[model samples]
Target: MSVPLTVCISAGEPSGDVYAGMLARELLASEPGARIVGMGGREMADSGAELLIDIRDSSVLGLVEVARSLPAFLRKRRTLRDWIRDNRPHVLVTVDFPDFNLGLAAQARSLGVPVVYLIPPKAWAWRRRRGRIVAQVATRVLCLLPFAAGFYRDAGADVEFIGHPLVDTIDAYGLPDRRGAREALGLSDSGRVVGLLPGSRTRELGCLLPPMLDALDVVRESAPDAAAVVALSGSTSDASVAEVTAMATIRGARVVVGSTYEAIRASDAVIAASGTVTLECAIIGTPMVIAYRLSPLTYAVVRRLVRVEHSGLPNLLAGRRACPEYYQSDVSGRFLGSAVTELLVSDAARDSQSGAFSDMRAKLGPPGAMQRAAAIVAETARSWAHE
Candidate 1:
């Protein structure tokens, strides 16, 4: 009997945790006997990946926040290294969290373990210099977007576009039926409805949700019958929920946790923060007005570094403003309210955005990306065994 190859995976942030959990699912499907150890949030652990540490509660936004996390990072790094020395896994799979993962990749490489980076750093967007470290450490870069293949390849890494994992995740559940979704969430089955996705991170809710509530007032003025619902993530704080609940009482919007997909399906449109949620909204054919705000320091630093013209992924995928996006100074209740109202009331505008979503969907590669990546990881592990 052959020994199973072990894979150590790490995903530090919320979005990465999602994809890492999906990867863990596929890895288990592909190699049932293989051991998968990871550091991530509930999703990965729920998928049965043994976690060394859970970064679900951890949120760091800017350089200042990153600096504060240095001690914890050092401890995590040391622990993973010690585990690597003793366990000697065949591969270290990193899912985003570039700052932490890149260093760990280097160490894993030094220890003669193959490193595979799933959703490697967006070095093309900023810090192109960091791609050098990814190239130096990782044996393979499994890129989620086709556009990134050339960028990572240019960085001198062995790169493959694994397609967006969302395709499969979205497909597995199938599209949400609006009537059913509305019923499930206890929302009205009729009239104009819009989703409010402040963001998955705490900092985002603090900066963004107030503006969204104010915007909802503007939306209500126009579409008096319009219903609004806020999708909540597991990491959302109780205080944030209390604030949203209070705001909802005054605004007549429902605040729902753990029903993001249903909320997206149940809505006529979504006012979303610029992140993975926008892509999720797009995949479901929902028209969204994307709004974003960062800490003054984080916004200042990010604006200077980000090379992309669009803040929303759908817009980025379209290479143009398929969905209207407001950032920093541009984010306003009046403006966001106007956009949301237009989408809810105007079929032509909503159809145009939905059509753009169809085009964007075609470019997102195919479904089953997690399983495909698992097969690749298994093959990579075998190659390491021979080496």
Candidate 2:
């Protein structure tokens, strides 16, 4: 029997680490002899990939944060590039982290390594020119969202819609019973529970947490029994956790930093920053109000460049307002509190929203997407090694 080929896969954030880990597991399951190695967080390392670097070091968000971390980022980039050049793997797979991933793809292409981009950058949303750059570097692009396939195809990239991995993950977990979830989170039955998901990035926490805590305080006055919980990203720092805890305590809200799913499942409503978590909430059938704020300069540039009407994934997927989104100047504590309160009090509204979320979930298609992605990567590697 022929030995399995080596595939290098890199993912530079918690979510990317998760998808990469799932993909690695699936690839190994299908081709037991296949070798997987690359940069990822602990989850991916635990799943079997030979860890080149921990993604935590490179997972900063926003222009300012990226700028601040430039030296460290450059050092890691050089190290990975050297590793890839020396190893010369059969295939290089990049999972999101577009800014960094795109450069890595370019390096792999220069080495004549076949590149498969998983969860290609959101060029369709803002930086449309990235499409052409991706087309030039990647042998193939596998997209999670249906619309992404068309965007990349039009931009001259070979693309496939593998459906979202979130669908498969959520399906496997199943929806938690609302009451059971509340009990698990130690939430009271007499009042509403609100989930606060600022985001996983340090910059996002700095921009989002204070306002969210302020909103929770306002919410408490109107509904004295109301409780708030913060979903802490595994990537968060002890300092950030302390900051969130102090703020939550001052507001009389509970803060939980590691288990994101439990917080979402237990909440009567969620106020989240726009990103993957919005889609997760929709798949879990949680009612949510999505909001986001960027650095003034970033927002100013993005506002003009971003072509989409909806910022949240659920809303964009539905091609309608599946959830309310507040951006930049529009995102205020009062507005956020009002949105959460509306969802909490209106059972009929929640039911209708839940039904819409279910429909959206159905559109996401079947489970095992990670396995499918893994199979594709392994097969591609095998074919290349023969050449």
Candidate 3:
């Protein structure tokens, strides 16, 4: 009797879960007999993977949060390691969540399983020494960023540039027509709209949402006709959503849950927490002000370790400050409001950002990243499993 081809994927956060789902679909489509399973959320399960773990409420953003959640993380790690041992999957695919995924990769390697790391850690930006560790464990790396491929290659890791998955996501979403988007989200067409994007984690809601609302209040002061809309990320808890909704209501901002694309389209400008959402806004050609406030301890540690010139993805991809950024103490209502207000009221400001966005898109490579990554995973499985 022949053994069924097994691919185990581990994605520790919501964004990575979405990516994992896409990859799983591609893998199953190409090889219907392949068994896909591991740790992820609804997306992966819906994509036909039997998830051993559901990653809801497990995302932590910074040093303090990770320290608090260490025990839980350790538990999940142990469970996954056991699964890997029992299954002995042909290939173990690790998606982002570097701190967790990297250790898992090392374990799989010791067990003689070939490991393919998708969207590995950003060692070029911080913890450059970790690049060697990645090179040591990963049999192959599928990178989303062009620069990341170069970085991994230099680290002596086998790497493939599959381009970025967001390009495909946005292209499929289609460019939003402002009037139509406003109608869909029930925002008034007469006034300028500002979207507030806090982030996907519980910690982000506590640390960033209030400041975003404060910025919205500031926008309303300058342009009384302007309306505010807040976008809730997919991974937020029910309690956190309710709290955020109540907070937005107090500030007169309408809360929109899971309608991120619509909110981005409805807005003339946005105040967004620094992360993938900024990159999404840029791809959608929405002008934005990026704000971030890490826990003080995390900020202190990150400030010293981070080697990048820009914190926002748009700025990093554009190789310049395409979006205005305010971090830590500078992430104030006054600063964020001024930047967002300029995009809302000034044609030149909006035009400059939109123009820069086009350049960033060019740098992000073509679509079909999921297909390429899926092919890589299957090839890796065959190469290792047959041997």
Candidate 4:
């Protein structure tokens, strides 16, 4: 009998874990005997990837947060390095978490392991230098955005635009029914509804949720019949969820856990953090206002380094400001509230924003992105066995 195929994936955050989990399941389906193992959270493990380390506790954002977690990063790095040296997995895949994953890719390359980067950093948006660095490190780069693919290809990286995984995720899960979702959230059909998506990371919630809640208060004043629903990410802590629920309850808003898409489907519009969920709302055809804040120091540093004109994914994909975006000091409940109120009450505003969603969806390419990515990853690994 020949040795069974083995692939290792490294995903350091919740969104990356989700995409990595989908890819792991696809890989297992094609090669039943293949062993998929790596560092990630419940998502990857549920998909049959054996966990070498659970990354649930290490999902920090911004430079200051990452610096505080330096010891943990070092530990994870040592563990991954040892695994690659001993197991010599046919392919080592790194998903997002650019700072950690890119370094891991370099280490894997040194150990003679071919590295495939899935959802690599947005070097095209900021830190343009990282584009060339990634080209030098990874054997292959799978990009979600067409523009990112172009940028990486131009930078000399062997790249493929597998399309945005959100399209695949939505297709796989099936979009939630508006009526059913509203009923589940205990929202009335006649009232206007606004969904609140603070973000997936704890730091994101800490920085943004208060302003989002404040915005909900502002909306309630203008549209007394409007209902609010706070959709918490699955990665959020029980304590955080409880606190958020309490806050939402006091403000007369319902809070749901693990029902983000449901809340989006149930709402006329969403007030969201500037992240993947903004794109999710766009795909689901919900008009949204995007806002986010970072630690003051991190914001100051980011302001200098980020070259992109827009922060929201919807805007980035549209190549224009399809959704209203407020950052740092400008991200306030009063501003976000006014934007949500406009989208909720003004048909023209809502129609204009939702119209842009069609163009954004068109750019994400056809579905089956994860299938394409999985095929490439499996082929890259299996071909290495022949070599």
- Estimate the TM-score of every prediction: 0.96, 0.95, 0.97, 0.97
- The CA root-mean-square deviation of candidate 2, after full C-alpha superposition on the true structure, stands at 1.8
Tens digit of per-residue lDDT, candidate 3, span 242-345: 99988889788898887899899889899998888888898888899998899999999999999999988899888888889999889888888888988888
For candidate 4, give the lDDT of residue 50.
97
Model 2 whole-model lDDT (C-alpha atoms): 0.83
In terms of lDDT, model 4 sits at 0.89
Residue pairs clashing, model 1: none
Per-residue error (Å), model 4, residue 153: 0.7
RMSD of each: 1.6, 1.8, 1.4, 1.3
Candidate 3, lDDT over the whole model: 0.88
Poorest 10 consecutive residues by lDDT, candidate 2: 56-65
- Residues 1-387 of candidate 2: C-alpha lDDT, one tens digit per residue: 176668888898888998888888887777768788898996789888898888764477766666777887778777788888998888999999887889988988888788999999899998899999999998889998888888999999988888888877766775568777777778876578899999877778878877787777667767878888898877677887888888778877788877788889888899999999999899887899998998887677778888888889998888898788888766888888887877888887698779889888877767767777877787667666777
> Superposing every Cα of model 3 onto the true structure, what RMSD results?
1.4
Q: Tens digit of lDDT per residue, candidate 4, span 291-387?
A: 9788989888888898889988889888888889998877888999999899988999988897899999999999899899988997887676678
> How many Å off is the CA of 59 in candidate 3?
1.1
- Give the per-residue lDDT digits (tens) of candidate 1, residues 1-387: 168868899898888998888888888877868888968888899888899988866867666677778999889988888898789998889999887888888888989999899998888777778788888898989998887787989989999988998887787876559999999889888787889999877778877787888888889898888888988887666877787788777878899987899999999988999888998999988899999887778778887888877778898889899999998877888888999999988989998998999998998998878888888888888898887
Off by over 4 Å in 2: none
In order, candidate lDDTs are 0.86, 0.83, 0.88, 0.89
